[model samples]
Target: MFRQSLPAGIGRMMASMLGDSPPSSRQGADAFPSSQSFHTTATLAAIPDPYKVLGVDRNASAGDIKKAYYGLAKKYHPDTNKDPNAKEKFAEAQSAYELLSDAKKRETYDRFGSAAFDQNGGFDPNAAAGGNPFAGAGGFHGFGGGFPGGFAADINFEDLFGAFTGGARRAGRGRRGPFQEVLVGEDIEVQTNISFMEAAKGTSKDVVITPLTECGTCKGDGLKAGAKRSQCRQCNGSGTRVHFMQGGFQVAATCDACGGAGMIVPRGSECGTCRGNGVVRDKKTITVDIPGGVEDGMRLRVAGEGDAPPTGTQAAPGTRTQRGDLYVSIRVAPDHRFSRSGSDILYTASIPLTTALLGGEVTIPTLDGEVKVKVATGTGTGDRITLSGMGMKKLGGRSRGYTPTGDLKVEFKVAMPKYLTANQRTILEVLADEMNDKTARRTMNIGKDSPPSEAGNAPTDSQKNEGFLKSAWHKLMNATKNGDGGNSASNPSKKESDDAKKSDKESK
Candidate 1:
């Protein structure tokens, strides 16, 4: 509990956190506590010491301290790492390293035994309390298992040699004292609701959030109303009570239950107004500015104005830092008729078969307004009519209009008549007859462009004669012969008649 090291600074440290106390110096190197029998604690018997944390010797040079600190820092600096507890370990290492790295303080710690700096032990150098911004009578020590002390190995070697350059040199003076107050707000989360139109179009609203606030009785300070905080008699001003086991052979460290702080606070009893808890409870109302076109489950962040900081002056629990961000989750309702497709919108439309065949104009729906769509005759069902720039907005971008929208993908479904009158049937019949007659005449009359061998083309006389002779030959060949096997009257013998004529002509 000595070092509840947090991510921020001292003002908000619960029981005293993230703070810096600078050192005030005396004239020359003579001011150093380097002499023996003064501030040094290394040779002391039996106690597990802080030197093991930074891993340097009792007489390690300033350069050595620098080298040790850098190496450990690389292994634990939370900023350069992903380990969950790296920040705390790094802070601990830093505190130890900072104290040892100072040549003057290191000398003072070396000369005067650690007990010499103790308030009740006679020679109070105010040494530990002096420029060590982190010191307050007593705080955290690694004995509690917070972080391993000697894990870093990347320290600048020059530091091990006690060089005066780099971060090894000693400072003459620095700032130190009780600091003023700066309370940060608490962290919180919230949820919001919106309509589909609002989600698509956009809107803003106010939300009220309730979280654990400060305690008002103590006026934000954890003291009995009108009471003051006092130092713990058990631990004295040093803040921690020392235990001597086996008659002081082995010494142990423990926190003072009375002080609650490692050292002293106000005095006698807590502030009556707050009853020791430094804060009070209250509700916060915030105006949330929602950007347009936010989809469902989208989040919005509202800064500050979250839960109030808890109150207490002791060093027990950690204090709050900056007010947590507010997250607004968006919920968009779904539309019944329209379906979104990225930058395109889809919908269905119906039309009469006659209208589809004859061509006509159809009215289509759009975001801006409705417009008549041109239906080219012979347009197939599902013929799409893209009304450009009419669609859903692109989620993340800078655009004045909706994200490349599209409109009216009207799919035409042909509608035919279910019932017909007598006159209608008659007209259909007549139309069918006329079409058939036209097709027959066209088939019979071949144009001049028709190929010569086509059957429908104009017929010549020789062709007609050949066709007739072929028909006659088929008819005669099928006739029955007379009983005498001479001739059938129906079938003519032209070759015989020709022979007789030739004989008469020869006789003449």
Candidate 2:
């Protein structure tokens, strides 16, 4: 396992205990300190117990640990907490939860002690080298690179720090080696509104977005021409440093000098285009192809079109930066004449009452175009006429131009006339009487005060009386037919009696 060089206070104490010279910083060619000189020994640097940091016991359940972590996080979150120590407390809680929540990590910590992790924290599978925790499975042994039964090699201190902190160094990032950290940019979302027809037929639209792109001059390296790199003095080129706690427990933290890159270009050697940043803000126009039959609230994704990673971030030796995705949110506007259900479309068709009763061909709008549909006789309001294969195209289960489609349902609505001509009224009344529509007959008096017939026939006074008598005779005949024996009691009118007497005299 790789251990970072000890701090000044701890270094002096360790030197006194081991009877060695005080640790001295290494002087590099660039006037930068690369490392510290110390004796080779598998010494244990104390770290806060995961249980104590979360204020929980060793026997605490996962639920209890999580609860404690959440409480600490909410109380000491940097955005809400104003105290200077709050940020450190929040980090401590996060680290504790990360370690204790993983069963394997917690078990290992319990078995081998808090500073021991699988490969990174210096676990010796062989255990032959005096059970020393710093004797790594690889050839390397201890902090000074030599042990009684092990070989010498460089140690990757970043992995050691990550193992101690439950891999917080690469949290939320892509999987990469300890030397190369892959940082993915953040996704961007934009909303746009389209008309109902456009949604059905599909349309192309251009969207403008301002995102961070790689700096052309620096080629995303953030380094100017002839710039020389140097080892970071803070972490001694190890990319990490140690923090001692109250109980002599030491925690590994990221070094601030190189932003965890382990190396740096001096202040004057920055890219002119991005000002030492690997990215620059630029506006780009993208034409998005909106497939047909896309519904409202549908999102379209454009790969590799999102923003760049944060500023001053440098990829290690071999890794490359990854851009995020661009998402377009669609909003379909409603239409007054049309509505949709799945792939089916509904259209309301209004026709005159005469056309509904007599049946006629009426033109209606469809997704394809306007077409004449036959309206059945006696068609009432809310009646639907389905035109197969005339609706929106299906967006699933098949490729474009070969997919099945839905039907266009045309619903009928009878439109009543506001006013009727005198002739039309009279004809309707006659028709109602012929049909024996009692409601229509009572609602509109049929004959009294009616205009002359369309055939120019006007009834005289006698003709009117004769017509009255004929109506009475028919009523009596109907009564007899119904087994009433024509005994519906009623006195005869004077005109009717006089007509009867004249008819009797003529018969004699």
Candidate 3:
């Protein structure tokens, strides 16, 4: 146990308690008569009645005793109250709580008063000289010795101070025991554009960056050669200041003068290169790697390529300064001929109507080159042809042999001719007649009694006068077969009737 020196007031009180005659009655008496007398008085004054110190009755419950001690401690803690006597009052409250809160100590105190634990009639002057007046007893000792049942261990100094300081004691101001390295550089972000093909395959480009770097002149010391250093006057070299807050709370913060370094160069000796800032803006070229399969608006990080720390400051004794990071955002240009879906590419190719109906070989365009593809007979518009492993490659190769390659999907669009020559129309008409004959034969085999009339032939008047239902059914069948619906006329015209009768007679 280590004993702290007593204050002037406590020393005077101790001396008065040790003398045979009252010191106040003596003319021109010294305030602290002797060192021995001072120690005795301090020990006696320290051992006050626990019930009186805590402001509770002798029969008060343990809960009552704790509540009183807590209230007094909150009112007297040095951090909360700025009064000169706050520390002493808090110590008294702590001592009272230690004795009254314990069942054994409270019972002993109740029966014997202050003398129960003191075997001697009065405190020994010789023992007081040794610094511990309550050496023999385990109870009611000052802060200098161990308590009766390890009672001092139960007191939480952090908790008591934390209630008022809000844990500021462990913040940035007091983190370092002697010195520590701190972050002084900031990260930077920029955007760049690349072609669509460059994005599909990987490409690299050099980028110029202008950012702050350590000054070369004065070697980042922020001072000229042989400059003198001095303690910071603003914070008295402690690197922190106490701030009085709105709610009667005091908080500790870093001192602005020294940037929490506790030392600075004298006023007349600033380095000229960085103008005492310790850093300067400079241009640097960095090569960036663009991986395949990266999407637009994606960001890539480049390590150790950003701003540098300020000059005139060194990292903590065992640590190194860390450079900032560079973030590069990518923009990919759009391709007119192709579109993408995840890892797959989509393209559309137009084919002639003859190639769609007759079937032929058509050349298809791809990313690498052109390739011949077979257009199956009757291939319709909007039909898709897939070429495997012809799309963009995966960004980072593959996983499980899957997602390594994409397919190129080619969609077919049939192009119809708008006009035909007279000779070509005549040949098409003859082909149409032959196709109709074959259709009529096929229909007759399926239970039709009569074959269909030839081209330029028509039906008789009776056939034209058939019931409206039969006429409509025949018209609908013809429209569907020809792929065209005629005008909405219900009856045949005069010229059509005459032609139909002539054709019917000829057929018969």
Question: Which prediction has the highest lDDT against the true structure?
Answer: 2
After superposition, which runs of candidate 1 have C-alpha atoms over 4 Å from their true positions?
A: 1-187, 212-219, 229-281, 313-320, 342-344, 350-357, 378-383, 399-508
Clashing pairs in 2: 46-249, 46-250
Model 3, total clashes: 4
For candidate 2, write residues 41-75 as lDDT tens digits.
Answer: 43223345779989999999999999999999999
Query: What TM-score fits each model?
Result: 0.40, 0.56, 0.49
Candidate 2 local distance difference test against the native: 0.66
Q: What is the lDDT of residue 68 in candidate 3?
A: 97
What is the C-alpha lDDT profile of model 1 across 234-271, one tens digit per residue? Answer: 76644445454331221223343532244333554665
Task: Write the candidate numbers in order of decreasing TM-score.
Answer: 2, 3, 1
Candidate 3 lDDT by residue in tens digits, 369-395: 899989999999999999999888776
**Candidate 2 error regions (>4 Å):** 1-181, 253-259, 310-314, 441-444, 449-508
TM-score of 3: 0.49
In angstroms, the error of model 1 at 59 is: 32
